[model samples]
Target: MKKMISWNVNGLRACMKKGFQEYFEAADADIFCLQETKLQEGQIDLELPGYHQYWNYAEKKGYSGTALFTKEEPISVRHGIGIEEHDTEGRVITAEFPEYFVVTVYTPNSQDELKRLAYRMEWEDAFLSYLKGLEQEKPVIFCGDLNVAATEMDIKNAKANEKNAGFTKEEREKFAVIKEKGFVDSFRMLYPDTVTYSWWSYRFQARQRNAGWRLDYFMVSESLKDAVADAKIHTEILGSDHCPVELDLEV
Candidate 1:
């Protein structure tokens, strides 16, 4: 079994001060993925002894970034989807193993008032296409802060959030298209009725009331669905507004 954990650290430097290292040591995941690191290269040097680290940084400093750490070295690693237009934000990193490809993506948020909704749609199409291309070579286990609450059950107040960025109808349809393309949402697949969330707003005492959204996910190709041993949301662990989500695969 291989244990994988994905978290949107919000800011690596800030999270480091909030028990990030302690949690990392305790989790001891075989493959750990992070999104929204929000730092340029050389900003931080993590001292994880047994893992090989790979990072993709945005050209614009302190904005968007991603990193992956694995106990076993991958055969190859790629930073982006190979599209110049979409590659600039450092939103993705893919690692290829013998049997499967592991992708960590920080899907862009449709900013306030749905300002970035149009670009987000384009990204959804391009990103899904990228994943499908990888599927042609081997099964995929992709996870990160997808930034969408896929279903009504995924958000605390679905009706109120209909026009909101992450919960907008347009964004939800893009996620549906992902399902149509044959990737399975591991958490919902295993626990369909469970109402758990990985992200919470900093305002309104959201986390205290458990008013959150299930924005992060672990998605696997259809061929690897049965290999999913467990999918979890680690709400108990706190360091960022978004908590870590875990996946156990019997690879």
Candidate 2:
């Protein structure tokens, strides 16, 4: 069995100060993925004894970024999708393994008043296409802060958040399309009625009240569904607004 973990650290440097390494050592995941690292290259030197690290830094510093650490090195690693337009933010990293590809994406959020919704929609289509392209060669396992509370059950206050960025109808539909296209949400597939969330806002003591959204996820190609041994939300562990999600695969 391989243990895969994904978390949005919010800021790598800040998270490090908050016991990130301690959690990392305790978890001991085979492949650990991170989003919203919020740092440029050379900003920090992270040493993980046995894991190889790969990072994609945003052109604009301290904005968006992703990193992947794995015990076994990948055959190849790609920074982003081919499109130059969507690649600048450094939100994606794809690592090719012998049996599957692991992708970590920090999807762009449709800020404040849904000002960036149009661009986000464009990104959704392009990103999904990129994943499908990779699927042609082998099964794909992708995870990170997707930034959408996909279903009504995914958000604590779905009715109040209908027009909000993460809970917007448009964003929900896009996530549904991903499911229709053969990607399985490992957590939801395993625990259909369970109520859990991966992200929470800093305002109003949201995390304390458990008013959160299930924005982070581990999605595997339909063919790998049976290989999913467990899916978990590490709500008890805290270093950022978003907690870590785990996927155990019996590969």
Worst lDDT 10-window in candidate 1: 55-64
Tell me each candidate's TM-score. Answer: 0.99, 0.99
> Cα deviation of 71 in candidate 2 (Å)?
0.4
What lDDT tens digits, residue by residue, belong to model 1 across residues 182-246? 99999999999999999999999999999999999999999999999999999999999999999
Candidate 2 shows a clash count of: 0
lDDT of 2 by residue, 1-251 (tens): 99999999999999999999999999999999999999999999998999999999999989989999999999999999999999999999999999999999999999999999999999999999999999999999999999999988899999999998998999999999999999999999999999999998999999999999999999999999999999999999999999999999998
In model 1, the Cα lDDT at residue 249 comes to 95
